[model samples]
Each structure stands twice: as C-alpha cells, then as structure tokens.
Target: MVPAIESVGIGRLATCLREAGLLLLLALSVTVAAWLIRPEKMSLRAETAFYELELDAPLIAVADALVLYDTGSHLFLDTRTAGPGSFVTIPGALPVRVTTFDDDLYENRDFLYPEDPVVLFGDGNLPAVSDVAALLLERGFEEIMIMGGDLEAWRRTGGPLADHQAGEHE
Candidate 1:
C-alpha cells in the first residue's frame, strides 16, 4: 500500500513538470514568432494622415520638440503676430512673424541655416504657421518641422515658456 501511494505521488509530480515545460516552450515560440514578423523598418515622421493641415512639412509632437529644445540643436520660431495681448513663447525661440517674413528672415538670416534643424509653432495661427513653413522651404531649408499644436499645447506638455512685453516681437 505504501509503495502504491509513493508511485502515485511521483506520477503527479512528473505530470506537473511536463505541463510547466510545455508552457515555457509555448511562450518561447510565441516570442520568437512575434520577433520574426516585426516590421523591418520604423518611420521617424509622425503619422499625419488624420491631420487637417496639408502642408509638406512634417509635424512633430510637443514632447519631441521639448527633446530638441533640450538638446539646443533646433531653432524654434514663433510665427504668431505680436499685438496688445501678452506674449509667451518657448525659451530661446525667435520671433519670425509671417507677415514680415522677408524682413524677419533678413534680420535673422545669420541664425537661419539650410542644414540646421528649425521648428515652427504659432498661437492658434495654423494658416500663418503653414505660410512660415513654406517660406522657410522656399529659402532651401532642408530640415523644417512644425510643432503639432499651439502655444497653449506646449505649455501643457511641461515645456518651459518665457514672457515678453506685448508687441515686443513686432
């Protein structure tokens, strides 16, 4: 009777070990299959298929813009018109009003370069934003990006902002 009980216990342990081994094998197989079928290449540009803007420039997220801002590798341009209202902008951003793009470009040409990265954003000024992007493209800028949302969006995304007197950019 004792031998019969020991045999039964050994049988249950072997069955449990077999099941656990099979489960581990199944998990490994799934992991390998997923890795084998993963996309060969990933696109860096943000998906803009759902966006309303039809401009040729690529749109970058505020988080990514923040990364660029941190690296200090990109020149940020503020495209909003300066007026009586209080103005806030990303730190180190230069004012380049679309209405005075030519003069602004001339004034800032030394800072503007075709090879360097440039990021443009506006305060609910989508049209002016596109205009600024186009103007920059025409001047042979190779890497011009537009921030996806307005200045308020930037503020909400933990981006640092600096205040300027009204019409100071004008």
Candidate 2:
C-alpha cells in the first residue's frame, strides 16, 4: 500500500511539472513569434512630432510674455485643459485643447494665421503647450514660442485674468 501511494504521488508531481513546462514553452514561443513579426523601422517624425518640437520651439520668459501681451503683437494660445468651475484664462488668450488642436486651428483660422507669431502657455511643465506647438509647426505656423512659466507664474507676475464663463458674451 505504501509503494502504491508513493507511485500515485510521484505521477501527480510529474504531471504538474510537465504541464508547467509546456505552459512556459508556449509563452516563450508566442513572445518570440511576436518579436519576429514586429515592424523593423518606424518614422519618428510621423509618430511623434512633439518630440521634435521640444528641440525646435523657443522658450519665452514671463516678462517677455507680458511685454508681448501688452503689445498685442502675437497671439496667445492657452493649452490648458478646462477645469471645473468658471474658466479663468489669461486676457486675450485663446483656449486650445491639444487633443482637438487641428479642429481648433481650423475653427480659429483667422486668428491662427500661419504667419502670425504665436505664444503658447499652460501648466508649468508645458507638456500640452509643447504638443500644440508641434502641431502648429506641422501646420506651417512659422513662429511658435512656449511661455517659460505656467498659470501660477502669470498670476505671480500680475498678468490680467479674465472670467471665461460659457454663454457669456466676451
């Protein structure tokens, strides 16, 4: 009876080990197959223009931005996402969502003329603004500048803010 029980236990252990080995082998085979079938080359520009934009767009200090705003010589594009509550934006800044940049550009084509000097600003890090700047460059916007600081910086510098409530006439 001891010998019979030993034999059963050994058989179950062997079966479990064999199944585990097969599963591991299957996973390895699938991984190798996927690796081999993956594309060998991709266009970096086509895939991510923003990466290039980071290298190209010039950074503008808050003081310079204030000067530009006062002169009204350049268009101010705010790339921040609208948050809950009344929208507070920089005076004369056009709200631009990076996700809908192309549509927004088309809708505001008159203001976003290709030749105009455009200044982009958003949260301090400038991720959304950078992306929008890249898209603008791709669309033939020649002069794009990224504001050095964010909304807080603008506030700190005494930049004017306007309440942009929906349904209210500007």
Candidate 3:
C-alpha cells in the first residue's frame, strides 16, 4: 500500500531538526538579554592597597604613641603601592614596600634593625597583614601594629599625605 521507503525515520529527522533550531534561538535570545541588562559596579567610596585585612586590635594613636623609634623603639611603615605614596603616610610613619621585594626594605641590617615595633599601612586594607606582622615578630620585632582606616581614613583626616597628582599609572 505504501511506496518503498529508503529511510526509516525521515519524518522524525525533520522534527528533530526543527526542535534543535528552536533551542538555538532561545539560547541566543537569553545571551542578548543578559548583555543588555548587566549589573553595575559598586559605588561605595572606598580605596585599597597591597592587601586586605582586619586588625586584631587598634594601634596606638600615631600622634601620641610616639611610634617613631629613636634607636630601638618602633618603626613607621607605609605599605602602600610604592612610587606613589612617597609622601602619603601616617603622621609619624615611614614607607616600607612588602611586595616580595628583595631590597633594603626586606633586609635585616637597616637602621631600624630587628626587635622594633613595625607599623604597617595599606591603601584600603592590606591583605595577609597578619602574616607580615608574624614575620616581623619572628625576626625579633617586639610588636607589629597594623594601621586601620587605610588611605581613605588617612587622607580624609588630613594626615601626613603626599600632594602629588599620582596619575592612573600609579
């Protein structure tokens, strides 16, 4: 009654092709919609530095603490991105680059030497700051203080900050 059929499922093959086309169209539609309505970035006014951290305790006020070491007291550290914060720092702090840098900053023979309190700083917050403090502690430093509030707090309060117009390169 029926003509000789060369393929068993010619009709089914056509239906499958139609379904595949529909699925492709749906996927493309979703992709386009997602691109048109993407989420926005954060607007919070915040800054960042070499690391992110939460200090275990508050550091003694830079002004009244006399953080600056005379010979074997304490060491001021500015752990911000180097070459930029040359001037920006705590009132009585000094700059120290801790970017796996192999220079005098990492050396143990500097004037401050070992067994001194080293105050570390960051832009918004320094990452692995506790580890750095621990390293300094292992090196005989008595106390390692991690400064809070970061560069934003320091600049907003008009602390010892540099005025140079650091460009995007920084």
Highest TM-score: give the candidate number.
Answer: 1
Q: Whose TM-score is higher: candidate 1's or candidate 2's? A: 1
lDDT tens readout by residue for model 3, 1-170 = 87787565989898889999999999999977776664422224554442243554345433323324334355666556556433544454544445642353444344456666576666644454554555556657666777654666555444555443222112
Q: Rank the candidates by lDDT, best first.
A: 1, 2, 3
Q: Give the number of the best model, judged by lDDT.
A: 1
TM-scores of the models, in the given order? Answer: 0.65, 0.62, 0.45
Greater-lDDT candidate between 2 and 3: 2
Measured on C-alpha atoms, candidate 2 has an lDDT of 0.76
Q: Give the clashing residue pairs of candidate 3, or none.
A: 51-126, 51-127, 52-126, 52-127, 88-162
Task: Tell me the spans in candidate 1 whose CA falls farther than 4 Å from its real position.
Answer: 1-50, 84-86, 165-170
Higher-scoring candidate on lDDT, 1 or 2:
1
**Which rank order by TM-score, best down to worst?**
1, 2, 3
Each model's lDDT: 0.78, 0.76, 0.53
lDDT of 2 by residue, 1-170 (tens): 35654455888999989999999999999987877775432223453433344544888878789889999899888888776567888876776668777766766766668899989998876666778888889889899999977877787777888887532223
Off by over 4 Å in 3: 1-73, 83-87, 106-108, 163-170
Better of 1 and 3 by lDDT: 1
